[model samples]
Target: MKSGTVSQDYDKNETDGKVGLKRRLGFFDSLSFLVGTIIGAGIFVSPKGVLEYSQLNIGVALCIWAACGVICILCTLCYAELGSSLPFAGGEYYHVRRGLGPIPAFITIWTLTLFIRPSSNAARALTFAEYVSRPFYSGCPPPELLKKSLAIGILLTLGVINSKSIKLATWVQNIFTILKMMALTLIIVYGFIEFATNPDASKPFQDAFNSQFPNAAQTAEAFFQGLYAYGGWNFLNYMAEEIKNPSKNIPRSVITAMCAVIVFYLLVNISYLTVLTPRELISSAAVSVTWADRMIPSWAWIIPVSVAISIFGSLNGGMFMLGRLNYAGSKEGHLPSLISMLHVRHLTPAPAMIISTLIACIFVIPSDLVSLTNYFSFSSWLLVGLTCVSLIVLRFREPNLERPYKVFLPLAFVVVGVSAFLVLAPIIQSPKVQYFYALLFMFSSIIIYIPFVHFKLKIPYFNKITCYLQLLLEVSPTDMFEDSKTE
Candidate 1:
């Protein structure tokens, strides 16, 4: 069955007061949503990984980064078509569910709510906190309380804004995104000028190209690691319902955002390399500031502020869309009903926002932004592979569904999808994350197919254990497993 033809009813008793979601986001807002989520700590921290991998040849490293951007763009194309066709909020959860069966859909949703989305937002928040505080205090910094409080504070502020009005939220998103892009542009332009005049600028392109990694495998490995830095290009697709004219805007936003980020990334790295030696760039934790100090000569004061603003904007965008995933699953009766309940006044899913935000805050309290980003990269890429496969499955199972942004060059998507899987496999080095993904899927399947579905399907002990553990940890319930009716 095609996704469009899937039944909306799932043993529910809904006959009155049913309403559709509010649509308030426009093309700019949607575009910001994509870019803001993508340009976070990855740009700040991933340069080290790239420099290490490319052995200081900033030009070649950028080419590899751009290559990854191309793959992500292809994935965004697939998502854009699917998102517009469905035009729902749950992002991948809704599409996967409609294409696959309820059980499998539940699993994808599980990974999203419990691990993927929440962890990412938390990572962003912590990065925001770090950048916000780093201006005055040097050294190792203060205790966890300061960072956690700041992280939670940002979450609460964004959550409240989102809960109040979709229009307000999108406007805020637009302003922040514009600020971030402008800041990046200024940095890139100024740094390029500095590179031209400075005697000790980056080595000639020939010298950079001649440099090699210790081994070919290591170079390939570093290239793949760099790919993880560009993971959030598809985040905006999750907000399909809120977007204006999703059919027209989804593809536009996805493609434009990808191009913008790629350009921003290439220029920023070029700027950084021009200012700092490859060794210095790799050694210092604050590469952006280093570039800013060297290039801006006059506006050094503005650089730290710019970094903070960029990180804040990125955090806001991630949280705004992440909540929608939970909301979408709830609407489908695959997640908790609370998640689906929009604040009547705010027109946003407040409960889901609160729950997701809390989880992010909790996770960010201890870990460094780089390590947390790596964790997000490994886990998110694994699920992304599954989402890609789900796309192929849906195409075969429901070929007749209307797609506004059809991909004519499907081979491109397939190749990129397979390549993405290859890039992600090495990072799944840990047993814990691997099992986490597996258990998350299995638990979601049970919730989607059994009791909530009114089927005689039986669940295994492992799922039961994981489910309770999740509940014990206060993770939002997976698989809107019950009807949205007053019992």
Candidate 2:
């Protein structure tokens, strides 16, 4: 296996004299990316599944959320150290590439670009459309065509926003992040008021721990649901190359975002339990909407609107980071060289954004939210485990390398152990054919890598083909060509 250090890679980049991504994101922008990406429609929609899977036990469900929060924080610390040390655009893929090898990195990004990210974006887009159409639905659910159209429209809209300017995307993220926070704040305040004034509202907490315990499969599924809500905490790391003073801001943003999210998630769940019974929470398709209807009927419409805005912000953040990942992969020649180009005017990865958005739109055709979630969670956590393990490997392989931030070894082990459990628990509890399909999807990267990456295969007239395609797509030639490297 080929082994190399990130410092060596940095030296190569300097020797190659590459034009790099512009550093424009500051501490607050990075924080907004972290927080905004994480607080998506999952919190609004997944709680019902979590409660149901946990057998409607308020205590177990909350504990699962808390535990996932802790695990996420620990995992964030690991990412903090890696992001500060490497400060690259590819996030986990870059970390794993430098720490493990090219093949492993290729596999990570392959699965991510092909499956994980598109599925996630599609899921969020569908959720956004569902909530937006909820108030319009008189009897049955909204028409499938309408939902798909809305999903595609939002994806394209966010794709355009991100492709145009990072500054604009950050502004959208910041504004919507605050709006979503306020929405949560409203829920928390109302729930606390109801808990204080109405003694009957306190019954949910009276026997919170008295419910029947769930089986192992159910517990794993519930934990997976909670972890999905906490998924985006590490998104900022993907664009660490763009963050100002990433060494200082990466860890700071991660710690702050994780802390705030944990507190808000706990309070939000508490608010849900306070206002609605466990049975009510499990039965309701949209728990936040239900809370709003019961607690503030006059302004019940606000919740779905808030959710739509929140999911939109998340879609923006996801697309922004997804483009960066594609750029990173392309820069290293793991993907098509065209995708690595940064637009001359906007200084954004336009090709990457366009391709990712197109794939996400394709994913919208399949409306299996549950299967998408399971596939995303399993494959994502599996890669996360490998990435965390890469941290330990790098520490030993390059003991004297500069680390602006470092996670303690014990905590790193905890992240690895927890990640392993998260990856394997569902499979152990209840094996599914989809799990195998996910694995097959990951392994399929190797087949492609061998011909394209390992053997350096190129089709006849590949450049000519890309040139014509680029012109047809209106991609500026200056922005579509660069000296590509595979490290």
Candidate 3:
């Protein structure tokens, strides 16, 4: 059962013109992808939720933030081992398929494709639109149609960029990531200066831990909010197949990205506290924006503009990986073969990109930012936790398999434990009807899988449809190569 003994025919398929993902991404590209994807609108917006749940206790809120960072880093390490060992597309789906079985793998990608990813993309897109429109608003909230249109417009722009060239997409990601970091640096630097000059600025920290204590449920919910901000740390693994020297790069990128974010998050929270009291943070809808407005009213415009840029970068990263997910699923014969096709001229998965874009656009209509975050966090973490469990199973089942990066067994257990807590805590605290609806949506994938994949039941004209799609989509032949057994 171990990957070393499994006799990977996948390599042969790659060499036999059966796989088409190009290996053009390097370490920095992946690093930028991770940072840009993780540092999106969550940090700007979720502080309110985190502060509220922590009962306005600055010390407790900071602890929850640090705890979430630890959990995210641990999970990243687990993914590092898998990504380096497998170095494939599809990320969690591939890991689960290899360690657990195809059924779980199918379900993982099914939920991600149909719900999790699209919903997430829509949320980021909407956040981008909201921030972009903020400066233009006179006194009333922007029109709903205006927001939706802007969201769709940005989605289309990113989709086009991604469809044309991955290089172009990564370039966009890198530039925006650097810009975002600069913006954040400005906030942190200015906040520190203000704290140094203003004698009473440390008042908030004086009694940081003395505020009203939250119940266990509230603490868990606060941690969940922090986790939402830290969600995209694992995105680099989704394109592992495209990363150059993946065995080395995957672990390095994960470590670098996680460490950078953890430091930035801790500092950002400190910066927020310096300018605003715990109660102020709880009441503010946009913590970062409020900080900017207070710190420099003349330059207040920069906050919303930078937030829009931050979200644009996230949307770009999301679309870039989503297409790869569809391509991975198609390669496994779990989805229509058309999705696996690479554009002949551009060397991108055009059809998959379009499909992902269209689905995300549809999602924009039904959900708001907060609900989308909750829905995605609950369901996606359930699978993420399962994927981490797969690492443990594979360690025992495939002990001989080569892993360039190996997470310690104890740490892996902690990851699984934390993931379980995150998945269950919200439901236990206050079960919403949406949780059941999300569950129903996930389980419904089983019906489609059994009839199509498990039983291999052919629907009418399926082959012809795939053939026509192949032609229309300009799918290149699959690439095949011998699987390297050793690094």
Residues 1-487 of candidate 2 have per-residue lDDT tens digits of 1223443343343335344566788888899888999999878766887888899888898899998899899999999998987877898988888788899999999988988898888988888898789779877899989999999999999999988888899899889888999988988999899989998988878888899999888988888788878889878889987877777899999999999999999999999989888888888888998888898999988988988988988888999999999988887779988787766666677888999999999989877743565655767877888888889998998777678898888888888888788778877777888888878878888999999898999989999987876666555422211222245
> Residues 25-51, candidate 3, lDDT per residue (tens digit)?
888999999999999988766677888
What number of backbone clashes does candidate 1 have, counting pairs of residues 3 or more apart or in separate chains? 4
Q: Identify the runs in model 3 with alpha carbons over 4 angstroms from their true place.
A: 1-19, 368-373, 480-487
Best by TM-score: 3
Alpha-carbon TM-score of each model against the true structure: 0.83, 0.92, 0.94
Reference-based lDDT, each prediction: 0.68, 0.83, 0.84
User: Candidate 1: deviation at residue 203, Å?
Assistant: 3.8
Candidate 3 CA-lDDT value: 0.84
Give the Å shift of residue 405 in candidate 1.
1.7
Where does candidate 2 stray beyond 4 Å?
A: 1-18, 368-373, 469-487
How large is the C-alpha RMSD of every model relative to the true structure? 6.3, 3.6, 3.1
| Residue range 1-487, candidate 1, lDDT tens digits | 2334321332121233344455567787788878877776667655877777777666677677788788777778777777776676777777666666566667777767766677777767766787777655777785567777888799878877776667777777778778778888887887778777876664654366766644565566666666666767768767877676777888899999899888888888887777777888888777777776666657876766777787787778878777888787767766655566665444567766777777776776667532544444444655565566667776787687666777755753674466575645554533356445445554656655567554534456745764564454343332332222211
Model 2: how far is 55 from its true place, Å?
Answer: 2.9
